[model samples]
Target: MATANADAAEVERLYELGDRLSSAKDKSQHAADYEAIIASVKGQNVKAKQLAAQLIPRYFRSFPALGTFAMEAMFDLVEMEELAIRIQAIRGFPLLGKDAEFISKIADILGQLLTSGTAFLLSFLSSNVKCGYASQVLSCISEENVERDAVHKALMSLIRQDVKNSLQPLFKHVESGSEIREKIICFLRDKVFPVKAELLKPQAEMERYITDLIKKSVQDVTGLEFKLFMDFLRSLSIFGDTAPRESFQELIEIIQAQADLDAQFDVSDIDHIERWTSCIYMALPIFTVWPIQLNNN
Candidate 1:
């Protein structure tokens, strides 16, 4: 029941598809072809999924109405257990760049994959590792997760527009858990924290933006997010401290805002205990570099 064209080499197959679409009496009538391609992406075959990844972006122009459907299909591809499949799909992200609305979705995918997603389960970030060496460290530490570099490059490219769209998605994963929290932090530590100022706006502007986000959204953050936000502050203080002396004071204010030093909770409540435990555990890094502004000053 298979057509000779279906099993052709990639280049040949794509050529035939282009001719078919270009020469067709009515392109809309190819809905079945479109559906078949979408179904192939979500199918069980690894190679087929890989092929579909390329096809999704290629056919996107002819089917602008299916951009949502195209993105959904790509989402399914990113989650595949196969590394090649994931990278193949990720490479397609920038192709979708023409559509700004997909930025948030792309951010969510990047954050999840870098965090606890099955595709790229990562080791905890090597702490106190000096700057100028993140790339080597990431490679050595996360060998099986080679996709780290791909995802990082994709993230950096995707953030060029709608930069704030990446914030909520990336921050949502920074919660209290083993692999989830630590690995995502590692991504920020290695990929995000140490970027040269030229990559985006100046570090000072970036710092101010996050500062304002925290000021406006601190109450909305969970215990885990608060803990993560503190870690983010610590990183910014270390690598991009144009606001150094002032940030130390601001850090004190943020801590005070989140703490109820005199308030007590049920001793048996495990969630409360864990949150406090994480708070204390996380603070060790903060205390280690207490008065961070001093070095920068």
Candidate 2:
């Protein structure tokens, strides 16, 4: 077909542009070249679109200049049949690892990707493909230890702006049976890795901010969310006696609510009994308190 030849020519042109951007020695000049490529791809004739698709990924990891430009161009590429390009975009997050500003910029792109209505972008985020890198990004965000307000805002931004409906995957990480909760606590405490001195240092403003969040969790309706919120509190070593007291009260409330709900149900039913048995067994040691022996008065 004559159309096939046009597609092939378009592909070659995209590849040439990628090569130019990748090898360009001057930073500003290279950026300009990639911008030209962006314009070329955007204005590509129908047959050229197919060619552009094939070059997207190849140019993605080419160089910082090209990589940054490609990332910026992703919003335009989503509608094209450039699955490889989108995949590269997700995978390339690691390249932005060391620079907070660049990482934030890419995070903005990720926010856009989530709402692009493209299944490929969603799958890239929610799928196992990006989990390891995603974890790395999370680790960086936590380590930066900017103020608590800033950290909370960044985390909330990633969840609310980027994850959207894709949040189920992250929520699953904090589920009742998931190991991430324990992992988080262990990492922040002296168990897995010793808490760094810097992390232990106080920021009055940040603590006050976190204290407010702790207080708000008490009014949260979702039991799982409340539990996860508590777990998050336990991970942050800065929480003091006041926060713990509030947390204890919240915990008792949750336990009492569970007791009341269980009492209203017929525990004799096989399925109910099974569920109750698991809950009680799990709660027994976890909820139990042992009386300390003392000298007789």
Candidate 3:
């Protein structure tokens, strides 16, 4: 094994070597240099790890293939006992995107972290750290013109199979009535637009789930939670076409009841008029179709 030097010259030499190796089209030469550089940096100090991280995005942009191999190797370093090394690895996941197996690799890494007994992985997902990776994956898959249905199905599969109970942890941030609510609302709103009808239409039990979700959202509101409620209402109204007239009537009653109760309680903060307007509009399309059928009969 070639010894790693403690001197700054050795660190710069390795960083520069990695940069050059990134462009080498000869696969064997590239791998040899990449491995040497990774090994050198592992033995070097924290500064070397930071330099390696800074190089990763560029590596990804240039030698995307080599970057994939490097990123996998970095995972071990991130899981290392050294904090600096781990930070470097965290910064390196973006490079993994170039790999065909990136999504599965990321999902597996996140799954392990999420299911681990310790809170480190959960905490990682909380704020800027982990969510970015998820967002990146979403954007990459969506932008690459990967099959929309496949991506949607994959997410639904995870929700249904792996993370059914785990969703509540992610929802806590959404439920906290903070800025994260906006992100959650945007995500769910997008869901409503593209795939909501398809996802909800096949299940006979969808009406019940929809009703329960909307009612729970309304009931869960203690303060001015009207914005998210409106978003949900818009989605429900847009996608609730397959629901029965009874479902529509039940929704109308829920809105009217809420409005009446709010008035009696002097809930000035509540936007009763908007809720009423939404319900009225939501009912119009259904009612119009029904009347046509009735007249034809």
Off by over 4 Å in 1: 1-6, 9-12, 18-36, 42-45, 59-62, 115-143, 175-179, 199-205, 213-249, 258-260, 264-297
TM-score of each: 0.60, 0.41, 0.38
Please list the residue runs of candidate 3 whose C-alpha ends up more than 4 Å from where it truly belongs after superposition: 1-5, 22-29, 41-44, 60-69, 80-84, 110-297
Candidate 2 structure quality by residue, lDDT tens digits, 1-297? 787777676667767776776676754556555555555556646545444444444444445556656555544654445444434334434343333335555444443343333333345556654557777455434433322223223334333333322233333333433434333222222221122223322545443444343444334223444444555544454433434444444444443443344355774666545544543443343234322222122
The best candidate by TM-score is 1
For model 3, the local distance difference test gives: 0.49
The positional error of residue 117 in candidate 2, measured at the CA in angstroms, is 8.1
Q: Which candidate should be chosen as best, given lDDT against the real structure?
A: 1
Residue-level lDDT for 29 in candidate 1: 69
Q: How accurate is candidate 1 locally (lDDT)?
A: 0.63
Q: Candidate 1: minimum summed lDDT over ten consecutive residues — where?
A: 116-125
The lDDT values for all models are 0.63, 0.43, 0.49
Q: What are the per-model C-alpha RMSD values against the true structure? A: 9.8, 12.9, 12.9
In model 2, where do residues sit more than 4 Å from their true spots?
40-72, 79-82, 93-102, 108-221, 239-297
